[model samples]
Target: MEALKKLFVEFLQAPTQENFLKVRNAVLATEEFDPYTDAIDGVPKMMEAGELEQALEVMKHALFPNLVLSPGAHLNIAFLLHKLGREKDAAFEHHISQLLQEAIEETGDGTEARPYLVTRTSDEYDYLFAHDLEAKGQALAKSPDGTREHDVLTTKDGGQIWFDVTDIRKVLARRMESDGEASE
Candidate 1:
């Protein structure tokens, strides 16, 4: 993960598209970077238990190892920092999250032919959340060639958005295959 760490450091120092893209590429290159499972899974529980500092520590562990390259992690970090009254740091993390969101948006237009590319399923919710939208339902779909997979989210406002989840599917498939092999 040294490559990811280097790219992440560069992105943090410059916050430029070039550096951010490098980090994104590195993250998408592997199935190991899971923002939800690695960084965010325990956050809500911690928050509900009134453990804000512990939540921040969880994020720190995820971020220090470059295990999360998701806007969701930064957004959570921002919220925790804000709760801790670290306004300046919170603002910085919030800004970084926004930048990461913009980078994700630049990947596609949310159309079936050009669906928004996401490394994790939660990113679909993050995109909807960022836009003040709510998903009423979701379905998995495939391209005509059956090569690309997408998550189609039906919005509360009677609209639909599509997220290209081909890579995520591949990762899940790999996990399932490994599980089957291990069981056998």
Candidate 2:
């Protein structure tokens, strides 16, 4: 298993189309491997297939910029960024990764998916705030007219839809915020 993991890292170092295929197959075949590893393999393979957008989406969703790649995500994201013609951003990610590595070593904590709420989608960063998330079923529908109720909304494509409350965590939990921080 350790050797296989090393093989994956080596694939990252010099990911040819062939290597990408090999790693992609290995990730899909192995149940014990991390989902992020599967994502790492999928990204580059998809890129080599000329699917750049799909590759970028995977890299962004994994927060790969913040991880150490030779293990997978780190290196793949770097390569993908370079392929995307974002060299400066790639370099910045590498620099930030070094800092992230230092933090990891000092804290000795493994990666955790810390959910951040989408505060706003600006041109640059999609601003997010830390929030708790829980899953529910699609029933407690919210009305578009401001009042919460069970209702169906019609789409422009001549489709009808009923909102699912349990599916979307509409419960807004309050967190104390300093006014000074919000203004900034």
Best by TM-score: 1
lDDT tens digits, residue span 1-184, model 2:
4554565556556544444445434543443323223444576578779997688777766542122222224445666677889998777656444432232222212112211111111100101001121222222334456443332333344433332221112221111133345678
Q: What do the candidate models score in CA lDDT, each in turn?
A: 0.80, 0.39
lDDT per residue, candidate 1, 77-132, as tens digits?
Answer: 99999999999999988988887788778878898988987767877888998999
- Per-model tally of clashing residue pairs: 0, 5
Q: Candidates' TM-scores?
A: 0.86, 0.32
In model 2, the clashing pairs are 69-74, 69-75, 136-166, 137-166, 138-164
* Cα lDDT, model 2, residue 62: 50
CA RMSD per model (angstroms): 2.4, 17.8
What ranges in model 2 sit over 4 Å off?
A: 1-41, 64-74, 108-184
